[model samples]
Target: MTDTRTDTRASAREILRTLVGRDDADFHEGQFEAISTLVDDRRRALVVQRTGWGKSAVYFVATLLLRRQGAGPTILVSPLLALMRDQVAAAARAGVRAVSINSSNAHEWAGVLEQLRRDEVDVLLVSPERLNNPSFRDEQLPALISRVGLLVVDEAHCISDWGHDFRPDYRRLRDLIATMPAGVPVLATTATANSRVVTDVAEQLAPAAAASASASAAGQPAGPGVVTIRGPLARASLRLGVLRLPDSRARLAWLLSHIDELPGSGIIYTLTVSAAEDTARLLREAGHAVRAYTGQTDTAEREESEGMLKRNEVKALVATSALGMGFDKPDLGFVLHLGAPSSPVAYYQQVGRAGRATENADVLLLPGIEDEAIWQYFATSSMPSEHKAEAVLGALGDAGGRPLSTPALEARVDLKRSPLELLLKVLDVDGAVRRVTGGWVSTGQPWVYDQVRYERIAAARLAEQQSMIDYERTTGCRMEFLQRALDDDTAVPCGRCDNCTAAWYPSDVAVAAASAAAASLDRVGVELEPRAQWPTGVASLGVDVRGNIPVGERLAAGRALARLTDLGWGGPLRDLFAVQAADAAASAAMTSACVRVLADWNWEERPAAVISMPSRRHPLLVASVARALSEAGRLPWLGSLDLVGGGPDGSSGGNSAYRLAAVWNRFEVGAELAAALAPFAGKPVLLVDDLADSRWTLTVAGRLLRRAGTSAVLPFTLALRS
Candidate 1:
């Protein structure tokens, strides 16, 4: 008789070859072992291999093997839409039927569910976020749990809050594992986990088996333990290097000068959306083909761009972290960063995109001086606040069991959108709340704020930030530094890296390149679209507003000299808003830019008057800019709007409801400004402010002015705060 091992190995190799569409395709070194543990031993396994490693192949091959032996279909919990799409295509090549139920394909969810019920699907993919979805959690998930042959969690490092990109949604997997049937093999795979994350995930993976082991004395069946297969994290094909520039300008120049010299079509990563869009535009203007990918990009647009990069149709994709993990492009030529990522682990994960299936790929970092400030700004919103948590809980409890939408809850809390969304996820995972069809409802479960855990995670993040700085400045082996950061003990100098050899990349920024880059960044003015619809739950906050504001009462589409995050005039604009800096008049250059904006505004009619908002933080700056624009356009200067009880703080950057509440009826259309505007009663008047955030301040002010008989309110600002 042919041995089972021989049969299994042969079957797996055949599937691998077919899946890759290569006659000689075979499993990587640890791939077969992971497959065997799953198929032969029926054991739980955690594979923490590097990016290009064949972790997906192991589970796919095993899934087929388990089905042949009469085991039920595999349930795969994936994290991204792109990943699910890729996995389904890969599974089909191996003759494994895969179906997914996610937000994008909601129209086809019924068919997919039907496929699952009929056992037509060999593998079912669902996002971790969907695991707690009320309908799925209440019905489909429980049925799937009873008969699932194998459970797989991709990008499993997210299961640990200690991981670099800890997602609270992934935490729901612990409860998932606990309720899983005994002896049902489980697989969790990731390319980015450090030792700490590995331990936490391993413990989480075996909770069911642990419980079964403890009950063995009472005749309950025992279960096997979790097995981990981790390998070296080094990429021999990657030549890593960091070139520090004096500022943003130099970095853009460096990218412009050397982009063509890079090996092949790849990625250009930026920290912010504006940077991605701006960089992509500059590259295109310089006669290179590129596209920008950010969290803000429409879903269909992102897919189209990803396909372009994969097919080598575009020279590069200027992107943010949205394109990070589970994106597979085996021969991706390079990964160039416009700014250093905040964490070393995240940096490694991004750069791992290159050299996966090639002999070599270039990886370069252009570290900017503004990188740290950007890092701090992004980090501030992630940590949950106890006070905010209590406020949200209190608001939910007072609802008397009715669900309150996120917008409605925002009216009752001081937290901003980003932080409030994060808090809701944390609460949902901790059993403190549940998300029903309408919105969120309290679970009435006891919740303890884990201050120490959050503190520890915060400390780890700081250490990682310092590590990223050290990585940038390190003269030692670059590959070794990254491997060590991921807690791989086998790390050693990769002779291919720049630090090991000489600098393989260009050192000097050509004068022409610098000049071109500067001219490219010399852009000014962005159209700021006016808010047409009022935020919901406004009346609850005593704002006396709901639904769409009448077009006659709305502020005309406005303009800003520049965005605070712009590559051109952003530096000067940022300096003006420094927290501790004394209020000062607008600088000459900024004043000139504002004049240029007015000259090019393309407004249908010139303003008959100028009005400034009451500024609590920068009265002089607002007054100066208003005065400058009025003098430049030769329009009447209608003194600042009056604040009744204490003008809207202008300092609070909360949600729309709160901002509107603070600004509503607070700006009085006093006689002084009204009298100045009376002469221009039938014409447009320019309303100026130092900054525009939430846009409600401008919205409320314009509504009042329109009601007081101004024909049109032309809103303008020094900068748009995104």
Candidate 2:
């Protein structure tokens, strides 16, 4: 018989060599075994290997081998559009035809659909989000599902709620796997999962494992189940280190002072979009070739930025997590985090981007005190609220089969856009709703709250955060610390880590660099544009307001001293607003910054008086700014807005519809304020507040001021929350 297994092995070797374009290319320890598991045994498997271990190579080779046997196209579900693009390009190198359908290429979806119909695509790459998309789900997915040769889930850790980055969309994969055709080999791969995450992913890969396969007395499975192949996760090329800089300025100064000494073009990760943009701008201003790649970057700009970095045209790409996951540049030099990620697993995954194909790569962390607060802001809202979930389901039920779009649902629900979308995904996965062609409709399926699971996930996250803090302070081998965090059994002290070796980096920041960085931080003031139109469906919230604001009811363009997320003044402002920080008079620096912002203001008409907004959290802070500005300009202090019906008690983070509803009719023309504004009837006035977020507060308060007889209300704030 000529040993069919040997012939198949030879064929797989050739495919791998062709895919990488090197005759010398070969599989790592478990790559070929995984391919054979899929190709020969036709069994499901999870590959928990580290980055650069050729996880993608196994799937591409298997897809080609199956195609040679007349199997239908493989379906590869990736989490990011960028990752999909990279995979499609990678597939091309293997001479395998691949097509993708995502938000970025809606115009080409029809062609892709046609290609799929013609059976021209060897692999179809789609985002996990696309699986729940109405058109894809209703019109295209069924046909594709019936014919899919193999199913591949990339970044599989996301399917586990215990993972650091648990996404609701990835939960849909379990349902997909459950309904897959019999005998189809499935593969799930990730590098960041710990023990819990791996176990969770394995269960999802075989959702009915307990019932479908029962071990006999011989300790063998009654049927085939998912097998996990894990390897040691130590990265030999990464020289891991941590620098405990005193403050944000010192970190930036160190970066400016020593960036040239780093090997090649690399990435500097930030915790926020604003931080990325600020860092990139500051670096570029200092004559460094860099670009900001954030979620806010448009598709074309993102492509250009990635290309610039890949071509080594830029020294770095200051980025948030948006640039992460499968962005391959083999010899990329360094990975530096401006602030630590909350989880060590997330940190490991991020730093894994570097030194993949190089002899040495640098990985460093600069921890910040503010990182915890940022982490809280994101983690607090990650799990869906039961109250909000009920509201969404009730709204959908009220529609009675009419597909309600996301915007319409937003109007009917109190949650914000991002959280609303997340809730919807969760509901869809829970069988409470179905995404149809138009939008979402109630499925009339009862959904449990899963309180226990949510609580456990939250607790796990806190522990992960504490582990990251320990990571920054650990004296043990840095690489070994990460390996143990991931539950690797083979962890040992890497000879190259900072703890294992000496401090191989410069620690002292130059005086000139520090001064320049401080000056850059001193740059302040952000222009605030007034909200022009009322939120759609506000009338449903019991407010009759609609359409664009009439000229008379609108506030003029305003200015803030800085954004709350700014690098320069943000720290002081954040401290001022901290929960435990007592309210006090404005600091001299703040008063001076306020005066400078006013000096830079080029409004068509200067304010003749000052009025403060009603403040529950920062009364003294707001009052001090108003009083200082009033004294500076020698203008009348018209007093603050009166609190009506206990004031707007809605929380700080609610969506626009509810925010407006909460404040509507809550403020009235206080007899004293109305009387004081009589003289400045048509003159502009500075309306001071502590912060500008959502802008709904400013809009509602400004409308009241305008209706109560005031000229252009120049809304000024100490910080603009972006």
Q: lDDT for every model? A: 0.87, 0.88
Model 2, range 1-722, lDDT digits (tens) per residue? 23766777899999999999999888898887788878887888888899999999999999999999888999999888778888999999999999998889999999999999999999999988899887788788999889889999999988999642356888888988988898899999999988778778878889655343222112233257776778889999999999888888999999999988888999999998888988888889889999999999999999989889999999999999999899989899999999999899999999999999999999989898898998887788677899999999999999999999888998899888988988888888889998887789999988889899889988998999999999999999999999999988789999998899988888999898899899888777799999888888989989999889888999899998888788778889888877799888899889988988898889999899999998888899999999999999899899998989888873677688877888888877699999999998888889999888888788888998998878789999999888
- Kindly list the per-residue Cα lDDT of model 1 for residues 65-116, writing each as its tens digit: 9999988899999988878888898899889999999988999999988988
Model 1 whole-model lDDT (C-alpha atoms): 0.87
Q: Model 1, which residues run further than 4 Å from truth?
A: 163-166, 207-223
Off by more than 4 A, model 2: 163-166, 208-223
Instruction: Mark the 10 consecutive residues where model 2 has the least summed lDDT.
Output: 213-222
